[model samples]
Target: MTAEEYQEDILDHMEHMEAETMPDVNSIDIQTEIQWFMRPYLLDFLVEAHAAFQLLPETLFLAVNLLDRYCSRRVVYKRHYQLVGCAALLIAAKYGDRKERVPTVRELKSMCCSLYDDEMFTQMEWHVLQTLNWVIGHPTVDSFLQIALSEVTYDAEVEHMAWYISEIALFHKEFVSVRPSVLARSALALARCVLSRSQARQSEWAGTYDPVVVLNLSNHLYQPSQVLSRKYASMHLSAVSTTVEEFLQRQAQIARRNITPPTPPALENQKPDADGYLTPSTPQKSHYDAVMQHGCLTPPITPDNEFGASNFAKNVLPRLYPVTPTSAPQEAPQQQPQQYSYQPYLQPRLAQ
Candidate 1:
């Protein structure tokens, strides 16, 4: 196909896949058998696994999408959560990666410390495929992102930071409700915001943008994502957090000055407190409490292949989803820019 025709075809495919794969947020209830907090923990392990397996970004996104779709339709026990994740990963790899790169049944079992044997994983993989109706090739956020990024002129650092923010969004429940195209746009806008402030002088492409337009478009597209907001506020993980804080400060300033900013549909029910920050609604189980309650607060024991069957019950199951401590020292905020510039891009054309 011609280049223009190829782009149009990709956009058409993205719309179709997004419609098929989008999760129904309203249908998800933390009070059900699976808790809300468990998602983040599960996503954390998926991230680690993706890194360990050196899987593609598209693979990670597809795997998470599959897991969420399955969890939304079924009531999965916490015990089977890891199995579901591994199965999702295996499925995603088969579709998105080379055969040699996909982890074997034994490798996956070893990764879970043999709490589940190869047969169990095999069974679970079939179950996931059945639950998902064999829909393994649907488009993901990364798929939309690749197309969106192609429309913009960005440096490698900007691309990487945008990717980091997008991956972080995968861990947030609120983001699950967002469309893939909107998510990609918001991530790119945030990345540009960070890049604008950090640079001593703006690049040529940066000069062609207007910050107000970018922020407005992003705000209109994405609701206040608490998990994403808090994550970006942390200075330890990325310098982008500092930029986000400064960007928010400027937004608050504009609002105080009586400039009407476009509000997103998701944030209509969310009112900002006196500090102009919106706190997320309480989850059924807080992340920390869930970690403690599930014995996920400590590092997991490495797999011991030589352990006897008698020791299996004590040493294996609990280690499947171990959690690391959460801590990030606060840093002084950066100075706000006198003027910001951002240019909004067009959304992908929808199919008729």
Candidate 2:
């Protein structure tokens, strides 16, 4: 299929997946013991974990998917939340990473501060798989992003910027309810808006695409992802927030001139072939392969000087497990070694 056709096919599949897996907003109450506030922290830790382990982007997405789906079905205690999150990541690694890259039970246990023993983690891993019905192939925002971005200009920087924005979106609870395709498109549109604003001073026609339309679609499709918005505002990783502010200001200036905003292109519906699949064209396949290999079209673009697993473990891990200084170092010893006396790792759950 042509790039456009491939994009359309991916969009169709995303729509179906969204319908099949969308979480029910009404059923989710974050105000109880499980404060909605804790979710962002958990996600932040997961992102750090993803970077720390140098796992594939697909693995991170799958891990997050499992975390959300399992949480939706079960009433997880706040204490057990981190354990569940770690278990999900472990399961995802086994599914998406090569055997050599997958972390061992001991490694994951150490990462979780050894709060839960190996048996606890193993039980939670089995619980997640059972809760998710052993399905781990959901189409993530990253996948849709690759397809959507290929249709637009192929600027490596812009692609990385959109990816950064999308990854930020994953940290917000509101976005969990949004469709992956919509999130990917909105991120791309925002990236384009940012790029256009930067060149507006030199070129009269720099702001070709309409930011109002893109922002409006995003607002209508998903609840306000304030965490994501605030993160962009605070981080120096990119000028996305400033660009967005400038875009709005420019839009207002253009509106005063009575310039009609261009109508955004409607998403086209493309039928699948007799084989029930849309074979991507050479260029499309190449772009897809690049994303699979490199996670994005470009190399890592995080602004932090040392953005890796070690940095994450050293900096972010402490925040999650605050260290209290004791008079004697021996007074507060590290986690006790596991006895492994609990039931077998894969004990079957009792039927309801």
- Top of the candidates by lDDT: 1
Candidate 2 residue runs with Cα over 4 Å from true position:
1-10, 30-32, 197-352
Instruction: Return the lDDT, model 2, position 281.
Output: 57
Per-candidate TM vs. native?
A: 0.58, 0.56
Q: Ten-residue segment with the worst summed lDDT in candidate 1?
A: 284-293
Q: Give one digit per residue, the lDDT tens place, for model 2 in 6-118.
A: 65566677679766876655445742457677877787777767766878777877788778887777887889989988998999899878888887779888877877898
Q: Please give the CA lDDT of all the candidate structures.
A: 0.68, 0.66
Candidate 2 least-lDDT 10 residues: 285-294
lDDT of 1 by residue, 1-352 (tens): 6675688777777777788888767556743666777887777677767767877888988898888888877778878988999999999999989777898888888888899988889898999889878877777767766666565554665666666667767766767877676666567666766567242124422233345434544453234334444544545446554555576678788778786666666745443343333334755232221233433333223454323454677665543552575788789899987997888987999999
lDDT assessment of candidate 2: 0.66
Clashing pairs in 1: 209-342, 210-341, 210-342, 211-341, 211-342
